[model samples]
Target: MKLAASRYPLRVATACALFGAIAVAQASVTQVSQITASHTVQQLAAAIDAQIAAPRFASSRWGIDVISLDTGRTLYAHDAGKLLQTASTAKLYTAALVLDTLGTDYRIPTQLLVTQPIVQGRLEGSLILRGMGDPTLDTPGTNTDWADQLAAQLAASGVHEVQGDLIADDSYFSGPSAGSGWEARDLQSWFAPPASALSVQENTVNLMVEPSRVPGERARLKLDPADAFPRVINTLTTSAGNTRSDINLYRAPGDMTLYAFGHIAAQSQAQTYKLAMADPAQFAGTLLQEALARHGIRLKGALRVLHWPQQADIGLDRAVVLAQVLSPPVMDVLTRGLKRSQNLYLQNLLQIAGVKARASAGQVADPASGFLTTEAWGIRALDELLGRIGIPPEDSQIEDGAGLSRQDLATPAAMTHLLVYLARQPYGAQLRDTLPTAGVDGTLQWRMRNTAASNNVHAKTGSMNDVRCVAGYVTTASGERLAFAIMLNNVVREGDEPSPSRTLDAIMEQLAAFQGRG
Candidate 1:
């Protein structure tokens, strides 16, 4: 075969060499493009790190974790194992636990029971209002008309008068009125109302104040529901012109009096103040009485509260059901709790879960058994939920269902793990739909506007005096879904600069623009 080498063979060998060079150049270009893409992702990480490491966050503690949902890969992590105060972001765990345990269709029931049957338009025994910790009992501006419906039912049943007391059976939840570790100063504020098994209007009263018709006169005051326990003491004087309003409202701990002082400008708009009620059971009882009166149903006795301990020996077998109102489904409760960061809704959910857990285990009826309180049982249920999702017990420090307590803590890794686990469950889509979308709805409506993260990120935000956090899902530019959590504690605001939220927004925007290697 080596016998004849002609001019044509040399030309063929040269052509082969040219083709090999072209293949080598193409491979190099592909390698360079991959390297550039990797570098871009790295640059994004570096930029986020720099922002967190800036002077403003020098004295603060932060935990960040981001994972790709498509590949289960860690995109970035910084102190991901560190425990931090979660603020309201802790509601995510509560929402998920409730949704998983109770299911999205579960509904809390509020029932009307009569101890004796009605005869000749009169009931011989007491009428009981049994509450199973329904937080949506009496929401303002919404006409559930539960009371009206109950009245109608009573009329239809020929119950013209009740000979005994209107009793409230709020024994479903038992423990301290508020969560453990709650600040005493916040007791009278609308955000920290007492948790009752029977809650009405979120256990708060809305007070509206208007400037007097003339200067130097007292400001007029009005309360919504008109029957909340707090009495108003108005000492405000209206001033002339558009002077800056100096209205002040104060209510002492465990007090039923609201003091409104200082001056309100005549041209100023009417201001509304929400004050927490002391006894939610009594508040609910009063509302029901009023509602009954409106329905022409007369009660012969006063309102009273009956607890489970007192009725442990007396059975409810003789009670007859007159009417009942089922609360909105658990899905609505979870949505309101997560999107609006409502402490009352989450607290009630935890209580309901506790009751169900105890009842399921057959431990609620035994007085000799070392039964846990509502708060304690709720914590246990959440711990069990976390264990099922592969998160260790040491990763969380939950003292209450709501994050209003200072004792609540969670690691970023744990939060991201929860998000990842939730995304894979059967009810994951419903759970995700409850989150606040970036600059679109819920708590995130005013954040990340006009940016890459806008309308693309669905997250839960947490904030307190010195704590800020955000955790949820984000859809990247490359069509990859991601789970992320960022928590900053003990953050101090610097002079004239924006809050730590801006830094968080910057990090989220960067993540939104990320394009992983295709």
Candidate 2:
């Protein structure tokens, strides 16, 4: 477990720039004094126990583990192997498997295969879209303009008009539309868009609004990059003379029926809202029509989703092999997924793994196929990844890699083990940088402020009612590196407010300060 020593100077420089000269000088002067590994371990254990016995955390049912990166030894443990619901911490395992199996350079490919060639400015055959499950397909960022570019490619293929229908082939993934544990209420939320074989625009729609100038008239609402979803009726009422507003949108199951609730101030020029979809297929169809219109192409037939290409001759132009679009490597997604705890991104990564595993299984009679279901594939991939780093199977339970399911569980020991493994990877810098810096970004932006760990610790955070977990790497003032996991479950706070997440964060900061020097 040789730690990256050069990072010490760079991190110190950053700390100085962010926290002022006084803090950097203080952190630098704290020199590393010689101490035996066994003695340091004992001291760290006692200090962590003392912190746990403190009154602020007296009623918390939590687990903690500290491992010496210098010697691959467990310096401290508290119910470290107990299984508990991990919430988003499940992404750690998901990221590990993806990094190992897919490799850091693996980019998801979205294919454009030509079925027919243009003849007399008219496509005589059908245009087929074969999806490769790129989650960022329709994301709004500048680099994510691939969908529109793809439209351009189709136009350049010499098909001025499609005589046949525009077909979407989303057969790469074999599973249900959504994850089983996804909350019914959350399904209509942007973060819970339905996962599909072919996902576009992250499977969501953008609702925009502008206040009406006429007195007593309601605000005007419209969809951006419209024509993707079915007609949505905004039944939400706006109040007069109100300067502020709240808005809520709901979509019924099975049908694209939408309901909008909330308020907006009068006379506001513009605002943007996110609306989840109940049927992604219909939404994709609508968008395809709009995009095609931009390129002077219209479907003479209808929209269809099939397991394979249509057998009938629809007189569409022959599809040419346009350039294929590939997503950023697995490491890029992993960093954002774990550090930011993006549920959709993590879920997509898991599905990618499942698809890969099933493909490897080939045409076997066994339904499991080592990856038939998400759990089977996830567990196998996890064990295989950990085995490469010498972590035993008995150390953890990884059910659904997203940690959104209550069935997913892991111990403090296993969590820290993952951190250790990530630190040794060649792309370890990207992994560490992706995690939320203390009190600066992502979930940790508000946590560890004004503490030693404020910017010194970078870790993944998890929350599920009474469960709170933070696991990752922490560098001490003297440059000693330690990996730790502090998980609290079934905590009893004085009032019925959210569990004491901030208090747990404080304790973690204190734990980071324990350099294990006696």
Candidate 3:
């Protein structure tokens, strides 16, 4: 079912008009706190300071802000207006922008366009698989594989065979394959896949390895979605039973070759590792080819991908949509992605938003006429949205929506202010519900357990090397609603025995237990 107030742009514009005046217009990051507060507030602040001031974290920096939504008052703050690495917490901004612009009822759709009609059992022209960046294309439903569903749709459309080439068109989103500020070394990691418009299995493949019966024999490896995986150079050896399994998978910068070295115990169970693929359009095209072949559809031409700058001859006069599929509601997609901190989903949403941005202010919002990269357009849209809500551009430097880049920075005050602003809008509750509940589910399933914050604090958690951050809503022990953002940077983990998340969790517990002059 669709949500109420589903007219997206209209609602967003209305919100801008309604709250633009309430937005703080400061050009710099600066926190506002009560000059005098009750003892309860002081104790909460002291307790949080203790957690962040530990000797082990002396080298780290923190930015925190906690405000009572009930009274619109700041209870505690520490360098809240300072710029800090946001990590995955940046997803919250992407989520808010899309939710406001696209609405909860919006559904991303894919279309199969063709220039010629099927004649008796064959297509006379190319079959174009046009995508609009729906990230859930590869996810299976309750009983049917998504790929099989697409194949069935094509079959139902009387596509018995294709006499021409199969074209994967991802012109919907055009930008660098890598997000802004993404390092080359991270390209091969599963979490660092390209932000292509056509994504299959999140542009990743799982490699399964089995130990050989002999202690010295090389291990056998198999990659799922064999049609799109990179070449794996195997140097893995099997060890004796009861021995530990040690494996290292390496991929060089700008190269697709994977080097697998190390050993697995003969008694060990099969191991599965997921890694990123190089090109999403190619991977998607290959998967569709395999699916069509299984469905007995004959293809007489080669499979190819058509990205931006590569125009397709659609024969606009006779171009027809053969089949189309709509994703689940955009809000549902955002919820699933945030629960797992899936970076691509957020990035794709931002890309789509950019595609909607106009090349010039006089021109209307159009996805096709922009000269700049989709990434640039998206960042511009984000800046505009923040300005509408009173967040100065100086408070944040947003390179990518997912915050994979160390260059992504946002003041704790900005994050908290964003949360407070969203909480006042009609879709605020929906946005809040998408966040991970402490110690209950999503990325926070294991955190804040057995504490006052357990299952109470709803927030977005950000994680990356040397950075940890969180921001969202929580109701204190006295039933006072609050908005907060906490950032920790330059964190150095000591041997992995203890995680800095514990300190974050401690800070949250203090906030959860606070009982002020309510």
Candidate 4:
């Protein structure tokens, strides 16, 4: 990307610069699109060409790359140098940064601290539950929460009561409550939950919607934490008979007041929705207080969630570690982030990683949003990673880890560059195992099924309004491994032709079936 247009042909020079590291030009039709690599490579190119040339995507832009892992050759490419909207594919770079900076087995811990001695369950001035940004404090598939786990740990430590304020210290992360570049509409949704240092239940609250016993009655609303949201106005009612179930959730930025409306069918079973939390640390404190009572640890003081500049003066230098809970190994946690496209997980990871990089650089925060912003510092760190990976600074300009920011952009060549670099590392395969598998598991489970690529392709799938992308590894029929990236922007699925998603599947199908002699 540093090479200007006068020296490079639009996208060709940039892509070639990365691919050239392989010691061979891509399969050329004439050595420069003249002498092709082989009949199979030509066939593979033709199939992809057909997909890209489809009439439906005539107005869209594409960025693609298919490189053989067995041989560092670009088997197929089209506009691979273009910086297109990456959607969730941006998480790949975040995953790489995590592996490079913190190994796969690293664990994030949340600790319970008491600054004063608890003599005969007394003399405690204040108790602190400090969060170190472990997004998975509550293990998956368990009917438990982080507060419950840590509260139990505290009970195991012999302290039966807190003599003062129960503080949920979220000061570990130095930034505003929200992520940079997230829009107002996104903040109202669950996916844009705050990436706080002390987060629990992934910074989301689950609401159960069950139909009333009789028609025309208000539906039963059950909030899991019961106090996750400070207030809720539910206008949901059950329909008269068997019909569609429609439920809606809305909230204003920085407000914990939730608005729930719409009706469910009279006969429909209960449905649950995971909604965003306005204050994650507050939610954690509320839940912890309930857990403490359940564990017979009486809390004599009110619960509190302390953020930076709010409880910034809380003394913890000599705090005794009463109890703590560590998240699952980072690898396992990252698997859920990559596979489920969990926005908070990726954003939290980026935010916390930047916290470290900032500490290392002796910096605090950036005033990007007119206040302290850890996200900007995080972006700078990821940008440095891109530079270290040899990806051109011009090829990408990512603003957030979840790729939910409208300003996020990355090129297929850069995607493949990061993929290939990570693949060559000692923990390369471990990283690959985190991606969604084609037609087997994760986001790609329902895609490319019963085809050559089915169960054979392990990749990450990403999508947004007018955007779609799939990138990862696939095994060819000849037993060769290939890394690929297919990105589309401004896509509009219309007419009778297969949509871009199907076209991607079609392209992958041919790539899996290709028997290359090179």
lDDT score, candidate 3, position 10: 33
- Comparing candidate 3 with candidate 4, which one achieves the higher lDDT? 3
TM-score of each: 0.86, 0.78, 0.86, 0.85
Model 3 C-alpha lDDT per residue in residues 1-518, reported as the tens digit of each score: 12121232233344354244224212211332212222387677777777788888889999999988889899889999999999999988888778766878988877677898689868998888778888777776511255566777889877889999989888778767778888765666677777778876787877788999899999998887785554678999999988887766666554667777788899789877666776678777777788888988888999888877777665645768777778889988898889888888888888887776644443854454447777788788888889999999999888897889889999999999899998998888888889999868888876666667878999999977789999988888778999999999999887643578767877787777777743
In the range 1-518, model 4's lDDT, one tens digit per residue, is: 02121221212233344345323312321221111222488787887787689777889998899887878999988999989988899999888877766678988878888888878856377888898888775546622566777788888778888889899998887776666677766665567788888887777777888999898899999987687888898898999676876666667677767777778899888876666777888877877888889999988888878887574566787888878777778888899899989988888888777777767666545333444456666777888887987998899888887888778888898888888888898988888889998767787766666667877888888887689898999888888889999998999866655556767777777777777743
Q: What would the per-residue lDDT of candidate 1 be over residues 194-256, giving only the tens digit for each residue?
A: 778888888888778798789888888888768776377778889885787776666665566
Cα lDDT listed for each candidate:
0.79, 0.66, 0.78, 0.77
Off by over 4 Å in 2: 1-47, 54-59, 116-122, 140-142, 206-228, 239-248, 261-273, 280-285, 306-320, 363-379, 386-395, 492-499
Worst 10 residues of 4 by lDDT: 28-37
RMSD of 3: 11.3
Worst 10 residues of 2 by lDDT: 1-10
RMSD (Å) per prediction: 18.7, 9.7, 11.3, 10.4
Clash number for each model: 0, 21, 0, 7
Question: After TM-score superposition, what is the CA distance of residue 242 in candidate 4 from its true location, in Å?
Answer: 9.2
lDDT for residue 495 in candidate 3, whole number 0-100? 65
Model 4 TM-score (2 dp): 0.85
Off by over 4 Å in 3: 1-39, 140-144, 239-246, 253-256, 262-269, 294-296, 308-318, 359-362, 365-370, 495-497
